[model samples]
Each structure stands twice: as C-alpha cells, then as structure tokens.
Target chain A: MEGDAAGIMDKSINVLIVDDYRTMLRIIRNLLKQLEFENVEEATDGREALAKLRAGNFGLVISDWNMQPMTGLDLLKEVRADPRLKATPFIMVTAESKTENVIAAKQAGVSNYIVKPFNAETLREKIEKVLAHA
Target chain B: MPDGLRGRGASAAAAPPPPPSAEAIEAAVRAVLGSLEGDLTAKEAALLAELEALGRTVRRVKAEIAALGVEDITASHIPSATDELDAVVEHTAAATNEILDCCETLERLEPQLGGEGQAALRGAITRIYEACSFQDITGQRIAKVVAALKAIEARVAAVVGTVARVAPAADAGGAAASPAEAAAGARPPPTEGQALAQGPQLPGAGVSQDEIDRLLASFD
Candidate 1:
C-alpha cells in the first residue's frame, strides 16, 4: 500500500498553479513544496496560465476560479476544447463551493475540487486522487 | 349742397341701420375663436418643450452620476478590494499556522539532531514564532480597510437611492446594480465566468470539503 501510494504520487511532476493573489500563490507553492512537488510554476491569472499551458508540458494544473480577463472555468473549457490539453489532470482550488459552481466545474471535466482554508493534507489528498486517476 | 355731403347726410338719416348681417357676425366670431385657438396651441407647445427639457436634464444628471463611476467603485473596486483584504487575512492566518507547524516539526526533530543543529533549529523556530506577529498586525490593518470600504459602500448606496428616488425613470436601466440586486432581474445577466466565479465564501457559507468529495463521487 505504501509503495502504491508512492507510485501514485510522483513528486517530480510539474505543477502549474493559477491565482490572482500573490500570497495565495506563495502559500500553495509552499504547500506543494512541503508535499515534495518541487517543480511548481505560478500564473497570476487564467490568461497567463493558458499561455503557459500552451507553451509547456505541465502534468497537473491547480487553479483558482476567480480572475480578471479569464476565469479558471473558461481556462478549463479552453483546455477541454483543445485535444492536446484535454487529457491533463486539473484540480480546482477555490472558495466557490456553491452547488451550481460545483456542478458546472464537474461538467467542465474538473478532476477534483478543494475549498479554501484547506490544509496541506487536503491538498495532498486531492492531488493524490487526481494523479491516481490520471 | 355738394353731392358727397348730401349722400352722407342721406345715409345718416337712413332709419335705424339693420342689425349686422349674419355673415358679418359669423366672420367676427370665427376671428375671435381662431385667435384663442392659436394662443392655446402656442401655450401647449411651450409647455411640452419645457417638459422635454426637464426630461433631458434628468437624463443628463443620471449620466453624470454614472460618469462619477460610483457603480464601478461599488460594484468592482470595493468588492475586489475587500476580497483582497479578506485574502490577506486568510493567507496570514494560514501562514501563521504553517509556521507553527514547522516549529513543531523542528521540535520533534530536535532529539534526532546534534547539539549545534538542535540549537539552530530551536532558534529558527523562535524567529518563526516572532514572525507570526505579522498576522495580528495585518488583521488589524485589514479590519480598518474593511471599515473604510463599508463606509464608502454605504455612501454610494445612499447616493444611488437618492438618484433612484429623484428620477426613477432615468435610473430604470442605469447603473443601479448594487450587490443586493446582483442576483435579481434588475441587473443584466452575468456571463458564465462571472456567474461561476463567486470569489471566496464566508465561514459556514461554503460547502465542506467532504461534502464536495461526496458530490463529485456521485457524479461518477
């Protein structure tokens, strides 16, 4: 079981985190680092995130829902529309837990959702579940 | 006598002149009615022009109020500012907890380290604890911003209410989309992204993580 857990959680996968808040970016980055995911990148909004996603071969995406110009939901839609990027695992980390939002995100092909004020353990669990399915 | 004087005297002597002809009396009455109608039409046109000018003035006032960007300030700036401040509080509190967690982790590892390493870890933990003081200061400062934003929001709402009352028709389709009516029919429908991006939720307002997990599981 421990070996399986280690196999599922490949620590070297590159992670792209999207948020408009610098502090949140730092916090998530630190938490990812604590989880031994050292290869983490950050984008301030969904537009920059899309650009980066198109430019790089990211293994996972953890994004916030609210941002100017482009939102995470729009980014998700764009990713899903693109055949090449549609298969990448995506986790939405946001404070939007409204049933409609959850249903919308689920329909948009989100792999998992984590509410805000979450700890490292919650993040790890979500990440593990996402990657395991990936 | 001269012929002209003789004719005038003869007409003056004409026995009582017959009452004015019917045609002549009717012409006289028609002239008076025409004058009265013309006066009434002119007055009506003037009154209508005044009313149209008033409507334009009210519209201009509404436009100026919109131009003041009160709607932008209340709808966009204040909400985003408060959200940012709330994020500050959330991040600081999270960071403080993480720092404490690190300190505890270090303490647990102290027994495994040499004397110098243990001392260094202990000192580092102390410094981290000291750094956690920022959370309190930041929270207090955020509270101030929140209070200021509340005051501004209230003032903007009052201005909006006054405008709405003064010229309800003018503001019927204007920038009166306050936060309260954001979900109502008075506001334009939100775009898909705007609808989905509800920002952060208040405590107990959002669903729990476990509930979300269950919800997602049900989707399968």
Candidate 2:
C-alpha cells in the first residue's frame, strides 16, 4: 500500500488549485510544490476554474468553497455533471467547516475535504488519500 | 293662627300659580344651551393648542434627525471602515507572500547545507508556511466584517431616505445623491450561495476537523 501511494504521488499529474484570494492560491501552490507536485495551475474563481478544467487535463482539483461568480460547490456540481470531468479527484480546501458544507461537498462527489488553517501535512495526507483512491 | 295651623291656612290662602309661561321656559332652555356652548368653545380651544404642541414636537424630532448627519455616516464613515479593512487584508496578504518567498529561498539553499542544518531549515520553513496561513484566515474574517458594514450602511441609508421624504427641504444643499439612491446604486444583489459561504468561524464556533472526518466516514 505504501509503495502504491508512493507510486501515485510520484506521477507527474497536473493539478489545478482554485481560490479567489491570490495569497491563498500562492500558498496552496507552494504547499503542493513542497509535496513535489510541481505541475500545479490556478484559477481565481469557479468560473475561470471551470474554464481551465475544461481546457486542461488536470488529474486533481483543490478548491476554496466561497468565491464570487461561482462557488466551489457549484464548480464541483458542474464537474460531476460533466462526463469527461466526472472522475477527476476533487479535494475541497476551505474555511467553511460547517457540517452542511461537508455534507454538500460529499453529495456533490468530492474526493476529500480539508478545513482551512491546515498545515502541509494535512494537505499531503488528503492528497495521498484522494489519489490513492483514484 | 297657631304656627302649624297658621302655615296650613297660609298655604291654602295662596292662589294657585299659572303653569310656567312659554316665555320663561324658552329663557331657561336658552340659558342651559348657552352654558353648553361656552364649554364646547373652551374645549375646542384647548384641543387646538394641544395639536399645535404636537406639531412642534414632530418638527423638533425631524430637526434632530437631520442634525445627526445620517448621510455622512452611510456615505463616508461606513465606506471608510470597509476600505480600511480591505487595506488590512491586502497588506497582510502581501506580507505573507513575502514571508513565503523567503521560506522558498531558504528551502532552495537547504540542499547545500549539512544534514542537520538541512533538517532544521526544513522544519523552520514548514512552521513559517503554517504561520503564514494567518493571512488567509484574517482576510476572510475581515471580509465578513466589511460585508457587515455594508449591510449597516444600507440600513442607515434607508432611514435617511424615509427622513428625506418626510421633510424634503432637510436636504436643501442637494450636495450629493440622496442616500437611498446611493445605497440602491452601491448595494450588489446578494448571490444565492452567499449565506452558506460564511468565512472563517470564530474559535469554538464551527465544526472541528475531527468532526468533519467522522462525518465523511459516516457517508462511506
């Protein structure tokens, strides 16, 4: 299992991170870099994120829940509804820790959820768990 | 006559009076009517005086409301508060990024150091990264405050609108657009999901990570 996780993590998978806050986007990107996932891309809001998701072949998506124009939940629903993007591993990284938010994300077919103020280890764990399933 | 007998005799001797004359009845009725008319006139005068006093009170209240400068609060002070909060978010974000940049630089230099030094550098970098998350949390909290300020500003502007309608001349200067107009123009229609997108919760306010994990597990 460890070997399998390692093999999955070692792959050069394209990752897309969505956040309205530029600093948050940079922070997530840096965290992904720390985990050696260098092929990371970003979009500021869900609409732009959807566009990027359609244009690119990203293996994973880490998104913030609250954003203008379109929210992360809306993006997840759109992704799930799209046949091509339905199977993409999605992880929600948000400040919204409400139970309803978690339930909504799960129902929308999210692979995992990470509450905000989380460290790199938590991010790593979530990514590994999500990709392992993938 | 003896006292009782004489009184009885005197009553018997008195001639029977004719029924009250029509003229006398008319005079008596007129006097009662006059008294009632006088009372009504006094009451009417008192009521008029009371109404005048009430009118004066209402005018005074209107003046007081105008003096409060509700327009300045909504137009100037509330916007300024939001702008300051926005600046706080911006400055913190910039500082956090700078810190992250420094950490990245240090990480890059770690490879050249001895094994112990490299480990120490990695630990410090990780801590810095974690600490820098304060920027995101604080930014979300401040954004929530800004949203609240806007809501308050809207409410104040609505009051101002009502006052302006009640006393149109109160805003004689016409220096700025009516507060109601400004609020209507400035306020964005709330998005559907805004209520659910509550920013960072205060400590002990929202669900914990462990609880979230357990909930997900239940879904499985």
lDDT of each: 0.73, 0.80
lDDT of candidate 1 over A71-103, digit per residue (tens): 889888888888889999999987677878988
Model 2 C-alpha lDDT per residue in residues B1-220, reported as the tens digit of each score: 5899988778777943433322234445455444454445776667655655655565565578788877788779998999899898888888888898898889889899969999898878877887888888888899889878877876676555444433343234432354555666797765534557888888898888789888999998
Question: How would you class the docking of model 2?
Answer: acceptable
lDDT of 1 by residue, B141-177 (tens): 4666796797787667656544533324324433344
The CA lDDT at B49 in model 1 is: 59
Q: What is the lDDT of candidate 1?
A: 0.73
Candidate of highest DockQ: 2
Considering only N, C-alpha and C atoms within 3 Å, which residue pairs clash in candidate 1?
none
As a whole number from 0 to 100, the lDDT of residue B15 in candidate 1 is: 50
Give lDDT for model 2.
0.80
**RMSD of candidate 1 to true structure, Å:** 20.2
Worst 10 residues of 2 chain A by lDDT: A2-11
